[model samples]
Target chain A: MKNYVLNNLPERTEKPRPFGVTMAMDKGLSVREVEDLMSIASGYIDVMKLGWATSYVTPNLEAKLAAYREAGVPTYFGGTLFEAFIIRNQFDDYRRVLDKYKMTYAEVSDGSIELDHDKKCEYIRLLSEQVTVLSEVGSKDAEKIIPPYKWIKLMNDELQAGAWKVIGEAREGGNVGLFRSSGEVREGLVEEILTQVPFEKIIWEAPQKSQQVFFIKLLGANVNLGNIAPHEVIPLETIRLGLRGDTFNHFLNQSK
Target chain B: MKNYVLNNLPERTEKPRPFGVTMAMDKGLSVREVEDLMSIASGYIDVMKLGWATSYVTPNLEAKLAAYREAGVPTYFGGTLFEAFIIRNQFDDYRRVLDKYKMTYAEVSDGSIELDHDKKCEYIRLLSEQVTVLSEVGSKDAEKIIPPYKWIKLMNDELQAGAWKVIGEAREGGNVGLFRSSGEVREGLVEEILTQVPFEKIIWEAPQKSQQVFFIKLLGANVNLGNIAPHEVIPLETIRLGLRGDTFNHFLNQSK
Candidate 1:
């Protein structure tokens, strides 16, 4: 465990890191799976998002939540769950569920539903008062493209509404937001977003290896990334540290 | 545990299944991780393939192997590792390592190396004399297109040489061998192979959801699948049983 194999790799900002954070997506991992992930790869991850409605369907939700908390990884229900509650007109019930779980982080998103931008920000402000809020900006549908300027405005508004961090939504498939159908990043949109938003405040949901490589190469190893699959946690850390082939020469070339 | 929401789903041929099998790709998973996967999703998995060259990198591999064995899920080193030893004239050392861990299954593949068809079959025959040999056919490179006839010949030859199962070589990425660069299965090639090869003796490497769906729809729910990521075992099972949206209508429509 103390081996120096990662000696030449870039130093990631330490845990409790504002940037260089990884948010792993747990659609519905069993309680034992969470314990196992923590044992093997929690050091590489900062937060866990129970992906799209899994919190609703999964049994032993409390035990799963306790596992993540015991591991010191903050866990949040997926934004789709928030949207589900909002659409059902049961925001109070959702709030009660949050309180019951003692959740410290909550996601506010309008990805799967139609909501006024101002209304979404209002919900963010309300949730931010109770707990740390991470709001997502992007449609879940690949066909519903939000322009770069619109994206920037919404992200800024969400942050101003007191979101701890704004998550740039790319659904778990890694092709819905900030990416083309081919899973290629939209360069111009990304560049525009960078100019308007601080890198430390945006968690780009990169669920694929190529996307992880793209962000690490562009933003250094410290870029905040989200929506990473559980098994990919160690592999993503390897990519970030330049231990993997995709970024093997990244840190070495940086010194030159 | 006995919710049985998949009641209307396709009936999977239960374990000791001749076809409905899921082979998880375990590249360097730690001992605790293997244990965790076994606890959470072992019911969904049948075999564990320690991915290419990872057996060389993982420490406590014996412990990891033992965990899988204790869970009754057979484990095997990837075909690439076999080639690494063969090329180095260290095949005996490799076999000893296999014995050290009491491996019941071992993969023999030439996808990443230049082993003549006859020589590859010889290896299969030799290994099959001791343990169950799973031989993989076709090249790993997407650019290296092996003809349909060649695929049929190699698969037939390997099985004839005593391979328990002839694996159609699509790497864990599912973008090479039997699939296109876009991860689409080559329907014509697959159909041709099916004509020449027996269904029960073939394990298709369908790592992606779409690929799993494709095979399940075409070959029925009991198609043997391999290279499934660890976290995807349950999801893959859900897909097979038509519990997920993608396959929800598949079984229902079939019954009609």
Candidate 2:
């Protein structure tokens, strides 16, 4: 409504754009909730991921998908679900489940399991043939640290294996994977990875405000951010636009 | 639907009952979002609080309140709004705002501003005549630590001043007022406050999962909890019922 006016706010990328993608993590939000979320923040949101194995326990899964679909937001089952299926030797069933749900995107991740690197890439290739694949690189275990070189190698290999985009894992809490237990970003690792990988193709999993601010300040307004909570979508948009206090001065002096 | 069954779950007090109240914080939720949240978790939510001057800026304020009202959930502006009004010598205008919004509950707090304790009590008494008063008893500043005796005195005074209930301030992030910067509860302060004030008459603002688990375990299933996020309402209900892993073993050995 533009009830109150401000000047020179940072510009954000519109929908169907390659970069500036916002992927929200849905931890069992109801059908109505998804519809409500889409109604308000769909313009800011690029994709929705049903977090972890929540899609397995979440009721009315099809209805939730329909809500997002109607809003023109693509939905995907979380990588944990993929891991759950793979761990149970139900990879074929997982593929069929994707077709059953009419999913346009699929996430291939080894966050929860120890899988052979080639097998992970193979899964990405197979999934990419059927649906757009977003392969995540990083461990969910807080103690397990993957070196910058390894992170770059995996991201490159996954992208080479038909991954439309690679995800930098930070989990939903913004702790572990790209961040320390205290939620501090491993700046060296991130910088090193960016050196070898394209910035636009890596969606950083930043669920915390500080993490979101860090990425926005480091990568400008159009950084691809993932794993946002449903409610924080608008707040994150403001942060991206430098309307929030955290990034208020960030985009102020910069020429657009 | 009881899709999965478990034995020895905790029994929770139903709505229209005192205690066990779950007051969710609506930090500028759209009307559709409110309706969506209520549709799924109305049974778990006892009230909704418009957080910290956000009601002043939130669009569709009346319609959002209507959504909660239609779902049989009462809504109140946050104490910060009350402080904002009082600090500006607009207490009458604040009262008028309550009437204008058809608010059934009002919060009296001085978490942000410095107010004499007697004056704070007077506001509580005055607001009590108009709506149910939920007086908050802590500072928003992390460095400002109110002694246990002061918390006890403030809570007791507010209750005597006709407050329907008292709320412990833990800001939205659960990092101040009754909690340390690390998000750990002030165990001694909370323990002392419980000695003088009945647990049923106090709502602890616990936005973090671990804090929610702490209160649920200490106060049992029917503990009054406030400042919960919209999406966490269902998850909080599960915690109260021992359905979540955090409190899964807490209520296991307890007798209903």
Cα lDDT tens digits, model 1, B74-149, are 8888999999999999989988878887889999998878888888888888898778999998789777998999
lDDT tens digits, residue span A1-256, model 1: 4365645668888778878999999976878878889999877789899876556546567888999988889999888668656765778778887898899999999876789989999999899888899999998677798999999999999999999899988877888789998899998899899999999999999998999999999999999999999999999988988888999898889967
| Candidate 2, superposed: residue stretches over 4 Å from native | A1-24, A28-49, A52-62, A68-170, A177-179, A184-256, B1-9, B56-60, B84-93, B141-143, B217-222, B231-256
lDDT of 2: 0.86
What ranges in model 1 sit over 4 Å off? A1-24, A28-49, A52-62, A68-169, A177-179, A182-256, B2-7, B88-96, B141-143, B242-256
Number of clashes recorded per candidate: 1, 0
In order of appearance, the predictions have TM-scores of 0.63, 0.62
lDDT of each: 0.84, 0.86
Which candidate has the highest TM-score of all?
1
- Predictions in order: chain A TM-score: 0.97, 0.97
